[model samples]
Target: MGTGVVVRALSGRYELLDPLGQGGMGVVYRAHDRELERTVAVKVLPAQMLRDADFLARFRRKARAAAGLSHPNIATVFDIGEDAQDGEPIPYLVMELVEGETLGDLLRRTPLTPAQAGQIATAVLEALEHSHGRGIVHRDIKPADIMVRFADFADFADSQARVKVMDFGIAKLMSETATRLTSTGMRIGTPAYMSPEQADGRPADARTDLYSTGCVPYEMLTGRPPFTADSPAAMRFQHIYSRPPG
Candidate 1:
């Protein structure tokens, strides 16, 4: 399919408009819901991933787990279904579409002030807290996954920006069933924002997410990731051993 082609969804409830972007595990599309008369973001797994039994099973489980979570700071998952054309049983997650810039995009032009960073950080922290309470750890918590929206046009002086956390595709749930879901030596999550324990291939917990959260504010203030290296391996090493820049 072409980059921006409007493809019909598998369930036929929604029609995908065009490709918004591709992530590690899935391709996100901007789609319109005919029944609801609104726009939604759809994340569809790649064909290759669906063929992998382990990945497909875990993907469904994770999607279900994420769908059960409801929070203002977290993106709302509306529906899950397969593609109708191929009957490949591909799992696609429907999410509320927010018209705002990512934290990464905003940082490219101007670094957030300490107060601004704090505001964003607090919202993410709240999200993590809620997810953690549900026995879920957001393995990836980087600036790129954070969506920032202005509070209001009139209350500019007193308004604080709102933040919505996205992309829980790699989230690990603290349940017995999920123990064997993740593949061995298959490191997930963004390298630059990975926690030390995660970089070392250790099972992550809430603290691991907190460590990743720390990287966000650091990047917001410094205009760069806390760890830097020549390659992914070198970056992993830095994450494991080096102290963050002061």
Candidate 2:
């Protein structure tokens, strides 16, 4: 339960090293795969979340659905399994460990120019376009979810950067089974990056993601979210009605 707890999974084949971070839904860990002899990032759902059968079922379904998405700009999912201890049906996803700073951290040190921001945005957009073509909508697209790695900056007369998107935990697939996975009044996304429709508890579509992405470049350039307010409700109204400053 505490930080740096070693979690063994798959009958003691995988050993988690340390807690990378924790969010509302789950905890991410840096772990080692004994079978593969490599480091991996593991996302483990909390045991308490399993108490809500709907949330548990939906979590597993979403994990499986995300595993099916394969793109160079998207994190690669390696494995999915339940906890080895209690068998409470917690879904843990093994992902390739990326070795670079997150966009959030990068932005804190230096604001991105329009050219740099566009390159990163283009990579995210390509991943979204790929997922959307398969009827998947990523509900979370904040700066923290974007990862950047070293790549060639220019060819001859052009400049580019390699970017990767992580954490597809809240992705929604357009399928009959997906409807049962989501609950009412449970908005699943970061308020700062959520679209107007998403903040209003409406189902998110490709357009919603587009709106969210539109905010990212602005934040990268200005070093602030598009809107700021005292509460999530107020932010929602701003997202729906106000024009962000340039």
Candidate 3:
């Protein structure tokens, strides 16, 4: 919350180095762990948001959903806590700092070969399968959210590319006992990669993740999303009704 060069310690363990990126819910920083002497990604939710009961509930739910899983293809959540900053408490999550570029960044430069695309899809599916088996449905699956490590591209036995899926901020817990996260008729997820049921504001399950994952390969091969529109409203309509281009 200060100048670019300002260094701050969070929870007295994570030493903030520089800001990485920001999303709707929080700001992400590339930080160092004084305890472990390693680099990590710290997603910090503003202290004010923590004061709101509804937002705080959703934020914790998201973190808990992500923290439940352990897989090579998923970013690891190391720690979570609050840090006092100028008399305010800043809640933060310490996550594995993934190396290499995002799928979106790679695609922007060049399209992937069918074989390469297939490899990436398989890795992502493995992650989905593990999460789905635990009743967690990733509501968002897009190029930007997928990290591909070129260094591991030759490790075909493990995976041609080390693909790690990030950002489960809107993932839905698909069990009857789970809390009803979204309000009635409220929509969540990115329109460009949204599953049909998600776009229609219907209940999503493992199948929802399958449909969204299908979109990844389509874009990898065609160098574009299956459908596009001028506005998010139009995209939602297309996701619900329009067939993808052949």
Pairs with steric clashes in candidate 3:
none
Candidate 2, 70-98: lDDT as tens digits: 99898878887766455456557788887
Better of 2 and 3 by lDDT: 3
Q: lDDT tens digits, residues 1-246, model 1?
A: 224565565477778888887644557888999888999998776554554556656766777788888998998888777664445666677998967778888889676677788888999999999888998788878887899976662454687887899866444432222334345322344589888897888888889889999999999888899988888788989998889878
Q: Write the per-residue lDDT of candidate 3 for residues 46-141, one digit (tens) a residue.
A: 343544456545656767778988999998887777677677766678899998788988899876778889989999999998888887778778
Task: Tell me how far the alpha carbon of residue 118 in candidate 3 is from the true structure, in angstroms, after superposition.
Answer: 0.5
lDDT of each: 0.75, 0.74, 0.76
Each candidate structure's TM-score, on Cα atoms with residue i matched to residue i, is 0.86, 0.84, 0.84
TM-score of 1: 0.86
TM-score top scorer: 1
**Candidate numbers sorted by TM-score from highest down:** 1, 2, 3
TM-score of predicted model 3?
0.84
- Candidate 1 ranges with C-alpha deviation above 4 Å: 84-87, 151-156, 169-189
Task: Rate residue 62 of model 3 by lDDT.
Answer: 68
Give each model's clash number: 2, 0, 0
